[model samples]
Target: MKILHRTEIEKILSSLDPIPKIEEGFVQYSKGLATVPPVGELLMEKGEVHIKYGCIRADEYYVVKVASGFYQNDALGLPSSNGLMLLFSQQTGQLACALLDEGFLTDIRTAIAGAIAAKHLAPANITAIGIVGTGIQARLQALYLKKVTTCRQLIVWGRSAEKTGDYQQDMQREGFEVSIADSIDELAQSANFIVTTTPSTTPLINVSQVRQGTHITAVGSDTPEKQELASDILARANLVVADSISQCQQRGEIYQALKAGSIQGEKVVELGNVIAAGQGRADEQQITIADLTGVAVQDIKIAEAVYLASEKK
Candidate 1:
């Protein structure tokens, strides 16, 4: 079996557009064409590890991914995210390739998925983009968002002034006009398109802070304890979309909202259904939210794409 590192994987990915593949994966998953078991998680004192694996029906291979996040890694001058994916042949159960991406694929697939969410659910005319958190995902979300929205103006907020300033500089280098928001409310008031990427246990964006015609993609809340948006925000939204309905029923912002009795279970629709029906933002004034807990199909599609791309190279 071939073993590829992050450098090789990066080169392979440069030639591929993951948005469409990820979008298709979502559609297949929502249609019940994929089998993704419940996520396996381990909580640590300062970090968490997630084991996600699955395959699309009739696909050539299945994937098993193990990724972790240690928030304090930055202090040690190390990346917070790390992991790899193992791809195996479906028919023979033999190993095909090992992608030692060091969690780069996971990050890229996630960012692309955010772009997909924005493409389908966000308002056609975006005023400004608001980003929460100053981590790798925050930067990548803005980078991938350029695929769907023409708006290059970003308002960012984070807990660390130093890190937030660093984010501003980094994004500015990427051809985006970046601004540092003094508060979440400030970020909310300025940007119509918002993506939350922080792993906060408490809600950051409240219902009153959100304006009409706003589209919020909550990406940080994948576990049961992590939350970014207030439960009232989901309740107030005109349209709420989830990457996986069953996954959302257990975790993410949707789960919190449901548990709080703020929103009904039936009100939440799958992102794949929205994409398939070509139904999104009814009007410019409607409030929309897409809760992404991440999915195994994403890993399957991305790993397959990377492996195939490497073969061609």
Candidate 2:
């Protein structure tokens, strides 16, 4: 089988249009054309591991991905997360390729999901965008935001003053008009489109701090122990959406809200359903929340995209 490295995958991703492909993946999943099995998980003291596998009907290949997030790795001069994807032929069930992406594919798919959430749920007249955390995801999230929205003002909040300042400098060079928020509350109130990228177990943004007509995309909490927003924040949201209802119930911000009886299990709408129906956000005044606990179908679709694109190189 052919083997691809992270550098090759990065090059392929630079020019790849993932929004449409990922959106189509969501549609196919919601229509029951994709078979996504339950995720296998392993909890680590510093982070966690997620094993996701899925196949799209009539697709040339199916994929299995092992993605890990070790928050403490950065101190060791290593990436916080890394993983690989294995592709298998649908027609013959033979190994097709191995993508040693080191979690780059997962990061891109997640960023795309964030952009999709903003495209369908964020207010049209956005004044500023807010980002929590100054990690790799923080950078990717900002880059993807530009793809879906015209908002240029970016307000960021990070626990580390040094890191936050560094993030500002790095993003400003990219022409983002970045600002450093003093607190998470300030960031939430100032930016209409907020993306939380930290792996915090405690809630950083309060419900009272979030302004009306704000759109919050919570992508940090993919594990049961991780949370970014208070349960009340989700409770008060006019609309609560998830990448997958089943997965959210097991983890993510939605899980916290559900466990606290703040939101009904049935009221949670899946992002796939939202994409397929082409419906989201009732009005500008209504607060919306998109809790993206990454799904296996996204991995499958993104891997397929990378595989197909690399062939043309």
Candidate 3:
């Protein structure tokens, strides 16, 4: 099997628009259009806790994603998140290839979810951007934001400024007008499009701080018990969209909102319905939210993109 490195995958990504498009396609895939079967994930709490999972499509393609616990970095001096994508030839049942290093493929897919949120929810003339959390996920989301929107002014708020100055410097190097905010509430008030990428259990942005017409993309809440936004902020949304209602119902920020009696399931809109039915927020005046919890379908779609991208390289 051919192995793809991190730089190789990134170079392939540079020549493709699949990152954002795959998110859109995943919206379609989740809506009962594409034939993505269930992906199995198993969480094992041992020496290094992790979730190992794989997907199947009979004789087509199957991929597996393994996400280790956040503390894995402490032992290895590497980023906590890392995985391999194994691709097999469905027709011949041959092991076609393997992206044996870096979980960067998933990073691109997840970041594109934020990009899609901005494309669908943010105004055409998005002026400013605000981000909570300064992790790798936050950086990737900001990179994709620069790709998808025209937002010039950027603000960031992290749990500790001292720990994440590297994040600020990285943004500045990219030519983004970046600043570090003193508080989460400040970020909500200043930017028209806000992305929450923190792995926080508590709310960062307050409802009162958010201005009307703001578009918020809440990531990092992939599993139950990992919430990032306050329930009241959800209640303030004029339009709320999710990657999957079922996925969000079990985990993600929206699930926390539901537990708090802040929003009903009926108030939520899946991005698939928004894409297929062509009915979502319009104009620049509506307050919109896109809650991304990350899904297997997204993994499958990006894996497909990686396979197609590998065909050329």
**Each candidate's clash count:** 0, 0, 1
lDDT score, candidate 2, position 102: 95
Model 3 lDDT per residue over 1-313, tens place: 6777888877787888875556566555555655543334556553233333334343266555665455556677767767777766656657767775567877888898788777778866666788888887788898887777767688998877675688888888987888888887777767888888878887777788888888889997877878878888889899989887877887888899998999999999888777667666787788898999776666666776777778876
Off by over 4 Å in 1: 44-46
Candidate number with the higher TM-score (2 or 3)? 2
Pairs that clash in candidate 3: 59-90
Q: Could you give candidate 1's per-residue lDDT for residues 72-112 as a string of tens digits?
A: 99899999899999999999999999999999999999999
Model 2 C-alpha lDDT versus the unseen true structure: 0.90
Worst 10 residues of 2 by lDDT: 183-192
Cα displacement (Å) at residue 272, model 2: 1.1
Local distance difference test, each candidate: 0.94, 0.90, 0.75
All candidates: CA RMSD (Å): 1.1, 1.3, 2.6
Between 1 and 2, whose TM-score is larger? 1
Model 2, which residues run further than 4 Å from truth? 44-47
Error of 3 at 222 (Å): 1.1
